[model samples]
Target chain A: MAPPHDEVADSRDRAWGLRVGTEADGTEARQPVMADVARLAGVSHQTVSRVLNGAPHVRPGTRARVLAAIRELDYRPNSAARALVTRRSQTLGVVSFDSTLYGPASTLDGIERAARTAGYFVSVAGLRSLDSRSVQEAVDRLRDQGVEGVAVIAPQISAVGALAKLSSAVPVVAVGAGSRSRLPMVSFDNRAGAEVATRHLLDLGHRTVHHLAGPVGWTEGRDRQDGWRQALEAGGARVSRIGGGDWSARSGYEAGRRIAHDPEVTAVFCANDHMALGLLRALREAGRAVPGEISVVGFDDIPEAAYFTPPLTTVRQDFGELGRRALELLLEEIEGVDRPRHPVRISPETVLRRSTGPARRT
Target chain B: MAPPHDEVADSRDRAWGLRVGTEADGTEARQPVMADVARLAGVSHQTVSRVLNGAPHVRPGTRARVLAAIRELDYRPNSAARALVTRRSQTLGVVSFDSTLYGPASTLDGIERAARTAGYFVSVAGLRSLDSRSVQEAVDRLRDQGVEGVAVIAPQISAVGALAKLSSAVPVVAVGAGSRSRLPMVSFDNRAGAEVATRHLLDLGHRTVHHLAGPVGWTEGRDRQDGWRQALEAGGARVSRIGGGDWSARSGYEAGRRIAHDPEVTAVFCANDHMALGLLRALREAGRAVPGEISVVGFDDIPEAAYFTPPLTTVRQDFGELGRRALELLLEEIEGVDRPRHPVRISPETVLRRSTGPARRT
Candidate 1:
């Protein structure tokens, strides 16, 4: 019953985003001592350590509260700090990108939330640049923070390339880096999502669907473009010239101004929701009726997509699942659980809305 | 004279949200050493140490590159790590709320970018909740990361109240946590922004402007409401019963639906851009024309604001400067500079666009 990528959008709308991590990777420097947890949990240091070590005779309720205190304080002890099994730092590190684009920010938030729910302090190092040197430095930074493992929310090309060669003492997982990464990673099927969106437009009687791509050098953009191209080829429709942007609403608007001019461009699939929003404005300004004259599909069912002039039809990327899976995988590796090599791909769901509809006769 | 908060938005558009911090509050756990900095900078450990200690033996160019490597790797040494002057962690800790709201997120990005540019690595601890216990725990988590200083990006009432009572060994600066907070905080004057927004509508020949406010219990929400009421009172206009939401578009749409039923309502001011967007949609659905009949204005001129069907007229909060000022304040405190007590209040500017016009004859 396990799906590589999620098959359908589930009803579990838990407001997924960043909560945080596991393991007590306490460094020689002072950190969340057992006393801190004891004070917070209204217990003694000895009792907290006893719970941490999973010793017999500790009550379940006491253990749960102690764990809660430990989690709240982010007191994960590094095993090197002590000779006993009692040592552990319930902390996980995440390497994040600079931008707050809907996809990556949500993914980071998801991982952090899952990690925190599982009793760990999530430490994030947002990279100024994704060069190999910078990525390596970030890993080093996380190591300094005493993280037991790491999750790189890297969807850019440079970051993924750097990730492939990264060597760390603890486990590391890549989220949405790309399909070709050598390290363990989890990603939603952006390609599949694009294909579905394109097919929906094609099925609406449009001869072909135009693609508004993200900027060059993005893995998500590439995957989406590939999917759109593949779907067009599969449908025996002509692959048209692709429009591009740096993935900003303004860029999308500028690109949209041009895309709106083409009378033949009756159906368009945008790379993400923000861009689609701009495209909608452009179409409206040009006096082209949406769905009536042009059918549009967008990827990433961002919260704002539903409130667009005509509610947008978009591919909903469940970052909640993606983040949880990445953290779980990292935890498995940290805790000596076997980590599967193949990347986990969550398939996006194409949501039906007024933006996409049957193409009107020219 | 320097403004307590920024008086105007600057021309510098760095696409700021979260880049991150400085100082290597490295723990006893094995971390980024001078050797690591040397490796990254392609310099020797001696040179790195010399640069760190402010020694005159190293070349200016060499010192610059070594610091770059130190920053790139987040390899700031905690003072305890070395007895000599050769210790410092170029890292700053930020305690952030979990939501990706436009205001807070932008402020965070600005801080991170400023931190990184100034040769520091930023560490963020996102809170799952804003209760006092949760806020305290977040602060404790940052302490565990070995940050020399902290910035609490707290906006909620609970978080602000907790922050007022907070005591820490490291310097702490509050960002957007409300003006009433006792802590050494920096905030944008949402009250001033709201007053200007309301005043703009009243000047446009409207009797009074109805308000769509953020959920209760938020300091920003409270401040905005206060400003709106004050502006309405000043204009001798009837202050209608306020509308509210949990700062989401859906809530705005719901509120808009109700507001749209009333023909007496000629103009409305929304708390944030996202909610305004929903209001626009609902207005259209109800056959109310933006500017043509009902003038609408919003706060937070988010990137998508301009792309809205009738490019939204709204207030723009310059988070870049706010964040930099907060970080700078924290850094000043960290470096033993005299601390200032008054909270920094940044005033937002209203950008005129197509969303607002004079009230109809009716």
Candidate 2:
């Protein structure tokens, strides 16, 4: 078979040795082939191809000259067969937002680690926005790369609709996806985590808890809000809905400042730890003492969470598990098994930090 | 031209619809080719090829049946052209360690975002340790994919040596890499951050500052220790080094408790915010009040840093900048530009939180 376009081009360049080449100049002398390397290295063409592909059982000296000849000839292996038996590009495509938010970043790291452990390459694409077009474009680009599998780190609600339009030609596992997705996914149980944080505050004897949530469109926002609501309803406590904000410490602080002004709000559950940090700042500025006059709880026990004053009482999401599971699902698809779609769900655990305490007497 | 080995297999599987057909014999039948899909869909083979390759100008109806036949035949495109034009697998390989530390995770996110923006696929390989053999094996696996470029997120001292072995084959960029690497690299300025943090306390009239460093073997640990030493020496203030710990809150707390018991230590600078938090807990337990009796400063102003009781005063590394810069460098290499080999260092800024205050009279 003739070499693919890239290998042919590379081999042609290698044949030139030091000759300049450009796309417009299509005519070029072809480089030495497997036959040429075999002739020089005193090996069969099959042996040369096997050495080029790093097939396990070659003799040591034969491997060396073949490698030297490859270095001299700059022989490039055919990628098509490599993708076949391996059933992999050894590459993972990660679709994510462009922001530097803590949760997405952590999840990306875990995904990278898991993929690396499994001996796959990782490529990342960023969605400029959560719009359908942006997501579709990202997916299209990843598909064009001949990726074996894709792990989407999209957290926006729009991602679900956009991803649904994606071709299921390859296995895709989404992280922080909406609860309703048919695609295999791995995510932290946000709703349960929110409930745990809320109950911890309520158990501290606070009459009611104020809630500051992430943007309503995010899956995390919806799930955390749901958990907080369910916890409040279960306790028969009036759920005072505070207005929404973005997932940032600055937003949390703004929301926290607003809640601090209300005399009846003794405890509050912010959607994430960053927001809680902001809320803590606002509460302090508003002359409300943490765990003394007011208690606060946060979610996603980020690395910096426990360092917050009164150490944040928050929930921890095992991002590593999410990353590992997402890769596993993608691999399963690559392996071409007709296994039933088994979506993996990881639960969040709450850590008792110093941020929550018994409600102060009026 | 024949496609690269991997692409050929992928295309073959799709063209033949290997997933859809079965054989009465134990051996499986190859999926039908584009010729079959074209025959099945009542379109020319050229039209079927165009539809499969996503040619932009195809008519909707014609595109639809061709696509339907594609779903029916599962025809896949030949990877020959892609392999030739880009000399790219259209895949990027990333190697990282297993820990879920905040900095590395966030940096990975930034790189992933950038890779997506550039229209490349990502594959990740995670290492259990930063040993030479493991890193080499990981690199070899990535090389087997014929990756055009690679990014390694190794933060340990041993990782520096491992990267040298990976330098010859691909355009490798090391993230969180030490100064010793000759390969192009991007990293945060840990030393400068520590100096600025320590100086802030000294400016507040502290005679000396105690240190809580990360594990000694890591680049971060070494840079931070050097920075602290340089600052104390530069200020002509007393310096004391405490036994180091990992970048965790528990370790910080233990170090903090030990420091708090020594009345001479009035100000402390921790390697990271998590340790600062632990230090705070230890300080409280030891009856040393924050800012009143002891002042503290930390690095990596994570979101929860502001929520730490009295809020953590720390240094903030712009991870977004780090990610963007790394991407820019990688692209430059891919574009074959002449670039300087100096370590591109990003300066971390001091975030003034409430954790540090003026020193009190003894």
Candidate 3:
């Protein structure tokens, strides 16, 4: 939404306040390509293309016409050749999905901050899907702009593979990507965080914790579920599993409601904080008392977690740390330093809110 | 945060599932700038700059020498001229701060999505503060990049003034900015959202409602307090305001605990939902049964809102909508179309959850 016209006019004084430099107009007029001038001047296409590309063999009078024609028409040179020669488009291409989800957006902020500090500009391209074709198309566009390097922030399992191919061509970094390839990568320890949450519940004397996992295709979702399963198996507790969920609070609520209504469920761990929030509501509506009958724990101690009714007990992953480390690894690679191939794991801490408690006396 | 190398490698095959792109030689030679080529060619600096810019009028011999020098040095002309002719960089600069707060991050995502759809790339510059120097420096850097326009997501009152100065030279749209200036802007009706939250509590039959606010300098903070004050005045009820907080759950928890310690506080409308979550915990700790004793309503129906132990009844703003609208307005201005200057106020919807109820009769 924009402000009214009159307000904009009034604020025009405020508007022009900080601009520091101006570009020359004469230089812009001469930017027309040789082909454009040649077409206007009635020359062969190759002749015009040669004139624009600065071929030295053009006839003297023909060169004058080409120059005059170039002046008459305004065209910008192809960005590709310019990018190839300058080696500094001062731009960094960022490939990501158009998502309202918290993780990707936060990582983007981190990437943008890191890029700015390094004095480079950012050009973002969003992916419609993690398929190879979509990834390739986006990559081609970035390459067209002649960006110095690229950063892919998609968490889909396929993205790592898509990125592995891209890494050998350009300096590429993947946020929340697994450490499978030799290409540099950075991500949160999803499995460890989930394990911590599950173990916390078990330590409180809960028999076992049920899991509501994120979509299976994402590494974070799978790792978290694995962590939950690992903890349950380590404790010799039965592992009951629900099939799937998108990373949404509503899905969590639905999953939570089902767990609450079930007689066998005594404790539950949600994949992320948003889902845990939903589950909490579902449990309440089912006439269950949190922590008293069904102890619940969540991941990603988002800002809202502490405000949750019982204050959610959840594992907190530092996304800022994830981003910083990713940038560090990428910069190191960019500077031609050889870092270890092993993935650097940053563990999340458990925030003990009032939501988790000992099992019922049944 | 990343996994072990073998795990990432295995995941890559599962995700990408195809042979990686063939590796091309990553060695691309750097191009020389006009400044460097001019020195080598022994021509006037302007002649070398002009020859590279394709400016006519250089003699055949001089032009030939310049061309030879350019080829030898692999000279690359600066591509900044796109700004002069089309007056379009096809890029929008986004200035923001590092915040996981729902409003700013959501707004950022919305803008990015909208910008991508408009065929414009987004360059984000995340600042740590909204101080005059910080805002000025950020805007300056974007201007240096020759960005056609910019969108600032800074909401601090201090930024309002700093950004007001920034809009004149460059087309800028300030999102979640203060409305003190006539500069093109997009923001939510924080006052109205607060009024609605407070009125909802008042309509629930509470004699009086207590308020918990965010930091003092933010525009949202001020607007919410104003709305709370206006609602109290309209109801002819005495206002009881307590502890101020930053927009964090921990801060909210402290404020909530303070409010819970007060026996007379029956109804509370927190400035934002995260804080409301904290209040719920404090109330529970104080042994006050929600609705049966104390009632709470929050603002901003964040994803986690519905998942609160008792679902949270709060006001929700569509960040995606706000972001899209802001971009549309900026584009309108960028394209030199006449646009109104009145700030667009998107109404926030009240989401009814389980957190609010009729006040108990004492």
Candidate 4:
């Protein structure tokens, strides 16, 4: 059952440890193995294992001796050898859109924090797209590196077949991909957020709300747009043809230019804070004062949202909670706990600020 | 040298593959090993290996049969077996400050793109602090997981002793850490960027620019403060006491509130975009018009800068380039390439927009 080439790797591993030890400790020419610690402490290998694992059977004197031996030798148990013993790499992988957009970036930071708290190493694969081929490749690459589970933070859940195939390979939890798929997912209610924004504007006495939507392809954009439309229709208001942007401030500004001169448009709900900032600028340039001449609402209360000239009223998504819950679900799946299949959805809360107000007298 | 427990893992690997194959392929209940493909194709194991590795010297017909056999049996090479053969994990690690801040997040995205292009998996370790003890712990963990190299994107370059110790364990490249350390670093010229911002305001006829600086502990903040002071001295303008923020818009707003009513402060340069944004809000609240009564400039042209009410004038750092160059340096270190010892420093550019104008005659 032995692989012929393993001898080469084994020799290389020994040489690597020795070389590192020589340079690291200066005086020490070789790394001390567990056996060395066992010998120094006059303990059996099982006793050392019990001490290392924090198992209860080791006497206080024996534990103290083993710890002293370990400190004296500065021995670090080899990761590969640990994997060989436990069949766990203690590593998780994240595949995300390779963009520095605020939402994905914050979620990633959150996931990393959660993983560290849960005692796992997190690996990441940045994909240019969430197409089937890209996802397939990214997952395969992570799996090849021995990741125990994966968290995918991209929005293109339309690539359902590929994701379905991928989950069979490893435990996976989706974040922000919407709850469309049967896979375990932790998502923010983008639709609910948009609805709340639209309703708030509507309650401010606006006849109708113009929607500045995110790019059409994003699931978040689609859900939010749906919510906006639903709220408008429910309020008996006319639905203006939606203006779209790629979630950039510039694009929002451009969309604002078109809406600013339209005397009939008194209210707007932007899909994200950056675009809302741009829209506000365009309105300002057109001599339209926020919440006076026009009322504006945005989504995702990014750190800069409150600093906008008039201060933005936007949806607050707890990305930290989303990440923590995603990790919880991923770990559960990895441990093979048979829980009922229900996607975890967090409802976003609306933050009221100066940007939204009563419509001006016509 | 054989571990006695390996038989259990080996059997589990086989069973795991079969279960996944049954679930993934439906029709195929057993996952095909390389030997199965070889047997079906009537080729030696070496021939199958050659085909899998894309090595030359197999006849076209033999290659076709091997491909057909691979397709028929749905073979996926076992990762552990592959590790035994090559002894390379093809993974690189990144240790970063666990923050959703613009700089670190963007740089991390850049590193991930570069790593993927270079055909490597990127593992991440997010530390709450870049202190000496935390770094040593993180690097040790990554080393245990068999990362070929690490890119650290945090600033406490003062942790020189611990970082110096870490290099012996693995190849590492530091990003944003000051050039003071002997370790190779990819850093933005924070001082130069600050100088450009201050000089731009000074050139606009502002006698001196009040600085709204980031927190003092950050290397970027300290360097920026130095550059601001140096620029004022060179221009023969009296340097005022600097205001400080925590790199958040809210902090900037508070600093702005203190300065908005000051007749002596006609111009202000912030250390980062978010702080500048806060400053703008505070000025607006105080009825001070941008470029009319006061002028403002900021560093780090975050995506929303251009959409500001008066589009922000700022210094732009190319975080992508910073990440890419850091990865290049790390790869060089991993490959043991002999190179000059000087660190790589990228100069940021000043992006002028509507925010800055000649100071109003006092």
**Local distance difference test, each candidate:** 0.77, 0.76, 0.74, 0.83
lDDT of 4 by residue, A1-362 (tens): 11122234343444344235444433535456788889999998778878888999789999999999999978777666666457688889898884488888888888888898998989998877767898888887888777889998878755555677777778887888875777888899999999999999999899999999988767888889999999999999999855799889999999988988988888999999989999999999999988898999999999889889789999999888888899999887787665677889999999999999998777
Ranking by DockQ: 4, 2, 3, 1
Model 4 misplaced regions, further than 4 Å: A1-32, A42-50, A54-62, B1-71, B80-87, B157-161
* Residue pairs clashing, model 4: none
Best by DockQ: 4
Local accuracy of candidate 1 as per-residue lDDT tens digits, A1-362: 01112223232211010011112452223446788889989889989878977789998999999999988876764333331132244667888785456666677778877886787767677677757778777877776545668898877887777776653445678888778788778898999999989998998899999999987777899999999999999999999855788778877777779977787798888888888888889889988888788888888898999999789999998987898999988876665444346888888998999998887776
- Against the true structure, what is each candidate's TM-score? 0.80, 0.78, 0.76, 0.90
Q: Which whole-number lDDT from 0 to 100 does residue B89 have in model 1?
A: 48
Against the native chain B, each candidate's TM-score is: 0.79, 0.81, 0.77, 0.88
DockQ of each: 0.15, 0.23, 0.19, 0.39
Q: Could you give candidate 2's per-residue lDDT for residues B1-362 as a string of tens digits?
A: 12222333454454234433445653444536678888888989889877866888889998888889888755565343446443556566777674256676567667777776786656566676667788777776776666667788786778878787666566678876766677788888888888999999999999998888888678878888889989999999987887798888989887876778787888989998888888888888788899889999989987667767668899998776787788778776555555467878999999998888999876
Worst 10 residues of 3 chain B by lDDT: B14-23
Top of the candidates by TM-score: 4
Question: Which structure is stronger by lDDT: 2 or 3?
Answer: 2
RMSD of each: 13.9, 7.6, 12.9, 5.6
Q: List, residue by residue over B1-362, the lDDT tens digit for candidate 4.
A: 01123234443444354235434333435446788899999998789989988998999999999999988876766655665446556788988875488888899999999998998888888776757888877877787777888888877644555777787767787888876678878899999988888998898899899999888667788888889999999999989855799889999999989999998989998989989999999998999999788888888898888888689999999999999999999887766665787989999999999989997776
lDDT score at residue B113, model 3, on the 0-100 scale: 79
Per-residue error for B340 in candidate 3, Å, reads: 3.2
Best by lDDT: 4
DockQ metric, candidate 3: 0.19
